[model samples]
Target: MRGLKKEARLPTVYEVIGVLILFIVIMFGFINLLELPIQLALFTSWFMVIGLGLWIGLRYKKLQDGLLQGISNGLEAVLILITVGALIGTWIAGGIVPSIIYYGLSVISPNIFLFATLIICALTSLATGTSFGTAGTAGIAMIGIGQSFGIPLPLVAGAVISGAYVGDKLSPLSDTTVMTASLTKVDIIEHIKSMLYVSGPAFGIASLLFIFVGFFYVGNSVDLTRAEEAMGALQGQFNISWYMLVPPLIVIALLAMKQPSIPTITFGAFLGVIWGFAFQGIPFLDAIQTSYQGYSIDSGIEFMDTLLNSGGMVSMLEVILLILLALGLGGLMEAAGILHVICQTLLKWADNAGKTTLTTLIAAFFGNFFGGAAYVSVITGSKITEENYDRLNIDKRVLSRNTEAGGTITTPMVPWSDGGVFMAVTLGVSTMAYLPFLWFHFLVIIITLLYGFTGKFIWYTKGKEYTENYEDSTVNTTKFEA
Candidate 1:
């Protein structure tokens, strides 16, 4: 397969542009006119786009090998998502989720509303290592509380999304983070450290915004009856105890140890099943069923039931389906050299190192926009940007970091991307509605571009050499430079 890397002729600039326009039209129809489920739309796009990509590949005659390689590359991510679904399902059923709510509600107050939102969403996103999961689960819970308090739903949703992305960007366990580092071949730890330049400032600004927003926002007093009823329902449904906390703690421990995500999530899922039987008095078969089908507890209180009863692999089917379709499309694109053609065309216009960096970043952004998945963005961006990086004498880590900062972090802002779809669905707001409000995502993109142009805080080795033990030795000399 490696031998297939011969210099295949690229499509003309017009052909590349035409393909992009075609992709946009299909996406527009899928989102605006068809109004299909995000996953279904993604799948459909992949089928059509990949077919086109493959047809292009066949002209070069190495398309089959490329498709195989792309699938091979993506296999691990597919497995990881499945495990994540299981882990979350088990964690919820075993009472870890409910336990957090039970304890969290104990300290509930209106004054620190924004701070609380940040903290809760951060913790949940860190635990799940998925901004989407965090938003789907704890975000919903926070929204419920916000509604009860009569806070503006949009503001509450914004806070939840902000905090969730913070964890998604930072968590070593996050798929996008890992995939970013992996595709770029950067040390995961280094990649994270590098991200601080952008993520830290974005987070601080977002936090301050939430704080200021919360200060002027008036919310109703907490309803004691509703809280009490929710608490009672939880107590009756599960043996909600501190012991239920073990599964989440274990997940964190595994992540901190830098264990692979699939195994870590799988372990957590198994532990969840054990907890379900031991504490919740869930029958073994029923527990299995619930774990797969998402258990629903019919506690008398509407909000209480809404909070307590979720855990099931079945719930993630839509996501799985979408991924499969998207992967298929990605496979086809790789086979057809459609992405390569686009990259080569873009590179022709890049005149300087800074311009090259900026171009690569733009390419990544468009990759996410076109591909509709963060993983696709990183993988495609990394493959395409490496030549530009080498030509510019930039560090591979720079390329990798740019891939993430440009592709992964910006995904939620694109309405058709995986993160955007989930955010919109979870928050009950269109991606376009909240796109302007996602200052963090936009900030990361702009900061990445600025840093690329100025070389501010950009570290690298000075020579054009590749080695397994490469490290950044260049210091920031810009402080005194003209």
Candidate 2:
């Protein structure tokens, strides 16, 4: 945004509102009305945003700079996607995926598989402090195991996402958890305590829901033969063993040590390829091809073929394309002054404790909708709301909690966000398809809003009165340069 911010004037209020409305129209309208692909919707929106930038007098060079900055923000996720694609292929070739499927089929009950998926993924993400790593490893394996158990993929994905996000929000090692606290100068412990009030109940309720709903599927029958068939197919193809888990364990160890995500994931991928070639006796050329293009097999059985035939760098092409379009549009809109003006407008509604909290949540969602990254949205949401929380004498942890409500809790449900894209591609479940099952997320929203309106858990400055004199105080909202 360097050159564009210098050359472009702040957009008029009308321009800002128009862009938001137009984006909604295209995002929801085309997707709902015409059943267009999300990629196409993003493409059309990017095109329209470019037109708006030029109309606002932004030069091409400045616009390009803004676009690059936006893409730079999301570059880490795109890189992970590429490496994860390769990781999946290599893991499959290495006998790691097959081992999980083979052993998992022998034990997990179909009736409680989803409940187990929730707990397993939660522990994994909590331990590793990464939703992507959990998803690409355990989450993906759970999906295969769930499919074998005659469970629905969407239901399994819902459980995986619920567990992954729960851990990501709570873990001290998580970027969002750390970032949210740092932004407000609130202690990370205080931040975690604040979130637990709402998240605790949501997690409990979601666990039960998964259990109850999972049992409903067993209404017909639990055919153990289906699982046996899958296990047999896996055993026939690979030298499945308990130690095959070591590769994923290395991934967990590296992430826990806070290594760079791109290289860690890349190392995991290469290790899988080498392990597959060395141990599985897969041909050198075939292993190399699987690492690049993807694993392919003609296992005669349709379901087995679908489950095993996946991965490679090439598979992430569409995900990479969507990331560029969404982030590029976000960058252009911000450089054109649309996002800045939008932030300024939203602050006008934060005149009281309830309104202030509500505004924080809305702003988080707005930032995420336009920013294409949850961590970036955290910056915009918390920065814009920080002053208001101070003015109201509300605890800064309140700001951190509410901001995370949008920034982390509901992010995976927003299809255009990086979090959403990763979940969709990894689990093979669309955001909308898995949304209903993200019971914890929906419950958190309701509870967070009630906390804001009812003044429950809205801790104010301890030695000060809960002041209602916000009117006499002069207020100013600084524009966030996201």
Number of the top-ranking candidate, with TM-score as the measure = 2
Whose lDDT is greatest here? 2
Q: How do the residues 92-171 of candidate 2 rate in per-residue lDDT, one tens digit apiece?
A: 99988888878777888788888888999998888777788789889989999888777778888999999998878988
Backbone clashes for every candidate come to 1, 0
Candidate 1 deviant stretches above 4 angstroms: 1-9, 37-72, 120-161, 164-168, 171-190, 218-229, 395-397, 414-437, 459-482
Q: Using Cα atoms with residue i matched to residue i, what is each candidate's TM-score against the true structure?
A: 0.79, 0.90
lDDT of 1 by residue, 1-482 (tens): 87573333444557667777876777678767988666566556555654554443333234444545545555664565566556656666778777766765566665567668887888777666777656755676676566545565666777788788877877887888887888778898988888888778777777777666666554344455665666677678777788777777677667656676667677878888888888888887766666577667777777556544554676656655555555555565645556666666677777665676677777776666665567777866677667666655677777877788777777777765567755765455677777766766777778887887888766666845754211231211111011
> How high is the lDDT of residue 455 in model 2?
93
